[model samples]
Target: MSPRRSRKTSFEDKMARLEAIVEELEKGGLELEKAISLFKEGTKLVEELSEMLRDAEIEIENLYSEDDLNGD
Candidate 1:
């Protein structure tokens, strides 16, 4: 069998995929197994995206802190 498509690492791509999953779930036609799989994948995407945002926030804070020290 062919390999599964790789999950994206970028935050935007993850968000897009998560949104698509949500839309698919909302449409109400998926089999029980498929819905469970999508839900699990969506949960993972949310966790990864949350981590990315947290890292970005920390980076932004560090940049501002440096600017404050430099009187910028």
Candidate 2:
């Protein structure tokens, strides 16, 4: 297992890590325990990424509404 991480990372960094995990999983040589662990981590990253995108969508909608109100 990898050492625990203490520092905060950006969304892009998380995405990159997720991508690496996916590539590793796709190669298909990991033991069951390791595969399960990677799968769990990847799932969590996906949830976080989804939430971030959802929040961004809401922000964009708000900006459009404000622009409409101001006749921009």
Candidate 3:
């Protein structure tokens, strides 16, 4: 599979998981260890999401630059 396709799939999956994590956290009756673990996972997801967004933004910019170069 193409890297782009995989990344898109991963992004979607990560977002869904993150939402689930947030919902679970919000319900708030878990053991302290479990809550902390969920928080850590959520934090990691946020970082990954941010990085993916940055990479996408850069790709978009590059595409526009290429278009300009081609006089499109």
- TM-scores for all predictions: 0.62, 0.64, 0.71
Strongest candidate by TM-score: 3
Give the Cα lDDT of each candidate: 0.82, 0.83, 0.91
Tens-digit lDDT string for candidate 3 (15-67): 99999999999999999999999999999999999987774433334546766
lDDT score for residue 20 of model 2: 100
lDDT of 1 by residue, 12-57 (tens): 6789999999999999999999999999999999998887567453
RMSD to true structure for each model, in Å = 9.0, 9.1, 5.2
Clashing pairs in 1: none
> What clash pairs does model 2 have?
none
RMSD of 3: 5.2
Which sequence of candidate numbers ranks them by TM-score, best first? 3, 2, 1
lDDT of 1 at 55: 46
Candidate 2 lowest-lDDT run of ten: 1-10
User: Deviation in angstroms for 18 in model 1?
Assistant: 0.4
Model 1: lDDT to the true structure = 0.82
